[model samples]
Target chain A: MNAVEAVAKPAASKEKRRTFDVLEALIYLFAVMMLILIVYPIYFIVIASFSDPAAVAGGRMWVLPMGFTLDGYQELLKHSNIWIGYKNTILYTVIGTLISLAVNVSAAYALSRKDLAGRKAITLFFIFTMFFNGGLIPTFLTIRDFHLYDTFLVMVLPFSVAVFNIIVARTFFQSSIPGDLWEAAQLDGCGNLKYYVQIVLPLSKAVLSVLALWTAVGYWNSYFNALIYLKDQDLYPLQLILRNILITNQMQSSMGTGEAAVIAMRLANLMRYSVIIVSTLPIMCMYPFVQKYFNQGVMIGAVK
Target chain B: MSQSNAGMLHTLGRIRKNWGLYLLLLPAAVLLLLFAYIPMYGVLIAFKDYSPATGILESPWAGFNYFEKFFNSYQFDITIKNTLVISLYSIATFPIPIMLALMINQMRANRFKQVFQTVTYMPHFISTVVMVGLILILLSPGNGLLGNLFRLFGAEAPNLIGSAGMFSSLYVWTDVWQHAGWDSIIYIAALSAVDPSLYEAAKVDGASRWQRIRYIDMPMLLPTAITLLILRIGGLLGVGFEKVYLMQNNLNISSSEVIATYVYKIGLLSSQYSFSSAINLFNTVINFILLILVNQAAKKYSENSLW
Candidate 1:
């Protein structure tokens, strides 16, 4: 279509053309600049992570790493905190995601059923909580009441069943699974559980994968739960570990750090960038695998 | 009954008989009610000063004392103003990603567009603390990369995260750069739904690339845009405390001290739980108001809303 514009517009006008050429050129110029503006920080961080921590902080580094070294990675790896953080985060994401799927899928299946009694009320009860919360303090108190304070389970249990994921999954099931398929299974003496397990589960991986990825990323990035509930540093996830490093860095920098404190502070800053790369690397790799599910066509069974 | 069951039972009949779904949903329903709904009760402490020792049940009601305390504080108006101002500036620039998405959508399918999107989504994965740490490192005066670049151009390099003047702009624009590509996925998804037949027809009717986008693409995207807008407004007051808190240094606290962080400082750091609860209560109320207001606006304008 744009090709036709090039062919036809040339023969059409010479006077409406001068302003048009300049504007088109300018638009292209701005577009390129915007791309650079969006991407430069990520580039800057990656470059700095490989550079000499001191040199990077001093503003001598840019697109290329100056005095390139693996010192940051070495320092980061040596810290038990970093390792613990990684372990806790992985556990949280995996366990949290599994529970999330179980709850979301089962409840969604129940909600999708035409014969299920009180389905509307159940859906509303779930959706209503999303709209109004009793606020954070109340939520914290509830966590305390459950005796989940400073426990690893607190991190995963609170977000087990998200209404949004449930609704999306419910929609996927209701629309994609033909009633005839379930009828065929039931005629062969299969019950609801057996039919769902044998039929619905197999057909729902597309939307399920999307939900799983969403939950994993959410659990991986979660720090607030740790911040409020898990006060013990040993239970800290990667995000909380990184947050500690940042806080300590700020404190050292402010209190007029001695030589050792300066070393710690510099290493902390370097560790921050490297940890960003490390902690985020998992989910970044997961996106492409599930990218196919994030479309209306996929949910609408266009693929079949 | 025997005849009704023996004639032709189907999938619907099986579901009608089975109650095992209750077992499946039982764990999940219990967890949500315990964690999400139950905490809502603690919201009452906003009106009380019950210590952990006293416990919730025995704690006497303070009767609006905390609310009054929050209202009386000098930080009250400033925090509210700053929170709204930051969100306003952010909502103003929300179009950048949207426009970028439109541009990407306009291009014919190619690998370059895919590559551009992947690169843009990278920063969204970076944690808030690290993102701020990178910004501080990259913009630090004598040793930072961007700082040296500015120095090379013969201008004094500014400490971006440290400067009060640059705090809001830096925070919001950095957000745009990091998540712009990721967030644009919805808009791109919406764009894909526009019927190719409409574009083919528009071509026959003599519409240019820009014209087709201006008329069809923009209008087609309205519902998605408005739906997202309502959601965004619902979260207007609930800015990420971690990002803002990490970004804040003494120099920029004047601009970076938002309501969420203020509550954190008072509650967690200062140990004034009641006062912090009051501040948080205030933030939540204002957010509720904005959510309703924005949803109403979306419903009026586009006949779309979250509810």
Candidate 2:
């Protein structure tokens, strides 16, 4: 009886191992499928952008660039407005990120302090806005009333200090920066401002970088504000400008007729792919450097 | 009453002692007041027969007239239904990320896991316009990648972008594609935090891998999942404006027209401020109530809640 039980146990263990192997294989298959789904479109865009427009339109460009040419990129770059859009976008991103970080970090610091007066009420006040706000028309009117309708300040000022960022920053400060450090600073005759700027800010580099990257990315990608506020063509950010180019190309290709129409359609298809690559290239390039920090930052902010 | 008075005085004294902290908070407070709070006052326009010339303050009080109008309008039913459909579609796809995270966690190779994560997360950084453009290019019937694939199969390529019925699927699936990896980060973090001893114990008990995952890992992930689910439901009606707007065309406008885009059109394009404001107010109030209800439900059911 003991010998028979032993043999049965070995057979069962072998069956379990085979099931586990199959399960592992299934998981790998799913992961690979998801990877392809997420990546193929972006890759197709890259190769298509470089491929000859005629080949791309004819559906011959697959897996690799067919009749590779730089005409699409050349056409995009030849439009001088793309460069201005780049410059404007960069300026908005930098200036807006600085302002956002300054306003949000300071506010978060104050809120993070347990002894601050009316902190609960202040926090609620800030959070209430996240759930409710004036609709589009009223916000637009308010911007116009402030005399910031088409000005560069309109891009940076009104939208600074995101409530979500402030909350995350406040949470980071509370959890990470020790109360003992504050006490130690106080013992050294460090005032609140001095302690915040000298001790706390220096210690809070992780949260600061997180906030900076988030704010910069938001500002860089923003188009709605420019779409509504900036009427001046010269002041258009990269996104709004790119949107226009893409839309106009679509309209031109779809609406036109005859030989000129065919040519326009071909160029538009080329421009469409190139514009996507050009607009996204900078952000994509910056992403890898910040990706590790970003994962850590999001986890730290999200977990609590 | 005396205890409350004392508490108030204590807070005031603390504030006086930490005046510099108050100074630190001032700039953000002022910005919040001007942008967030002040715009809330503009919600009053919904209650008025607002006119641009008379301004928001001087506009004649109409007392639910705009609200009644919005409720009675033809656009009301379509927008609300469209919004709910799209949002529920999104909610349906929420579990995809959790499942993906669990699968990724099962990988034996650390290097492969990292590569999978990095590649999948890349799409989240793509701007809305670029994302929409990519979608269009890939789905374009005449010359798209999908079209080419369809041709390979000896089938006609359907106009996915132009089909109203296909709008929700495209929006939801593309959203899953872009965000599944990024959203799975929290779940991955939660999975890693589960005790290693539990897995060893389960192994000793002769538990299969699936059984271990079901009994041990899943239970550990529940609190985080519940918390995230509650938050997602709270913002369910606040369907992202930019992506929907970019994806909208005359072809699929029937399915694509959400409260946000409708508000933009009436409020800004056609200059029907009061009507759009009323529509927006309805949307926000419903969202707020949904948030509260979900938060309460979460608190009652589980230890995890937003409040």
Candidate 3:
């Protein structure tokens, strides 16, 4: 209550504030370091793609492209497999996303209905697969027996029923779409299919888009299915093509000794950087914009 | 008898009314039958001397013979050891994402927090193929980024990607880098749901920042973290096949030959269908048991569990 005591209290709290400031500073420092650690490698790849192979090898290029050239991209463009991969991946992603959304969203909605008969049994039927399944050999054999192997449909159809996506979408419908809405639709003489198509699908765009993006990304980046099922070169997706170029050491080659072989090898190394940038560019560009939608899916799941 | 007949008729009426719903579910049910259920039925081949020519059903019975072969094989110990080592190492780093989430929650500036999260989560969009490719390019001992940096110091860059000793570390840490930020999203959502009044109450009590995080934040994130940990433990042996298969070379095969990859190589590449199916059957059974055990333990110990 006294002026002297009030002044002393102010001085003591300021001292506490100073230590708090130090902790705040340390937190900021941690964030900045993590930012650098993640962004730097990606930045390096972008710059390295344009830089001359020799300069990149000599450590001359770090922050900026050193002795910039379009040689890597030029060489990559010349590879016909890369073009085939792009077309195949794009086709697969679009068709696969549509199939996934149709099957999962419909199933999700059907199960979301409290009045739907056998909802619990149907949901359990889907969820049980999540916990246990026959491993790869049996699955592969089944696909082969179904005659889906080595076909384009193999990429999109067999793996359509993603249980996790269905669960998330079902949660979204249960929580967001009211049971009264279905009752209202029924009173208006709308069938379950009509209500789902016209009303529910239109209203559930947020979750639908999120599921679509996830499925599309899965299809785009998929190689294991392609690797296992398809033996034809023409059927390969971008990831498989990238695997051959970047990991499998199957770079395009010509039989030439000494200097010519060395040039070919250097071009191959330089192409690795370009190939990564080319393949991942679309996802990276689209990610920042749609990042919130992906988070939306997580939040929906978390609430469940 | 009359009461039972009435109940059965009522159930039949419900099914007849909801026939459209069943129609909607038909595609998914059929897909599951083909891809999932049939594979399960096909797993019976593990107990048979599976000849692809004879098909899964017609394959002659050879109960436990292939299982015995796998148990007696030299690969049994090596594959199991490698799978466990990688999985346990990954689980050990599980706290990193929780810690990152906690740190991000402490930030005073909203814009900086968003930028930090976005940047960190960016790596996750990079596919497994590109990710392993980046690993090779950045660590290639001859002319990689590390190689170039080492040359500056007149020292040789060790072959990290191909090194048997570094296999697990490289796999786990790169996975951490790619996923920790994305994983933190769930915890961050959990943190955001914390009532601001709780923080105000803590501040009024003269609790320091660390004290607030300890008393308030830690308790809030505990249920979610425990649930995630249980799921992680349940799928302990289910290490992904993509990244490991991509990263494996002849040099590091000793440490990188996981159950998933081993099955792929054995069944598909070598066409030892019965042997590979048996190994796979064993792996799936163990994974399912672990999941059930962990879920049960969590249900008993805490309120949060996967039911």
Scored by TM-score, the top model is 3
iRMS for model 2?
1.2
lDDT of 3 at B92: 99
Candidate 3 deviant stretches above 4 angstroms: A1-20, A250-257
Fnat, model 1, is 0.50
Model 3, A59-157: lDDT tens digits are 888888989899999999899999999999999999888998899989998999888777788888999999889888889988887888899999888
Assess candidate 3 and give its lDDT: 0.89
Worst 10 residues of 1 chain B by lDDT: B7-16
Quote the lDDT for A88 in model 2: 99
What is the per-residue lDDT of model 3 for residues B51-112, given as tens digits with 9 covering 90 to 100? 97887678789999999999999999999999999999999999999999899998867899
Every candidate's DockQ is 0.41, 0.64, 0.73
Per-model TM-score on C-alpha atoms = 0.88, 0.95, 0.95
* Cα error of candidate 3 at position A101, Å: 0.7
Q: How accurate locally, in lDDT, is each candidate?
A: 0.76, 0.86, 0.89
lDDT of 1 at B280: 85
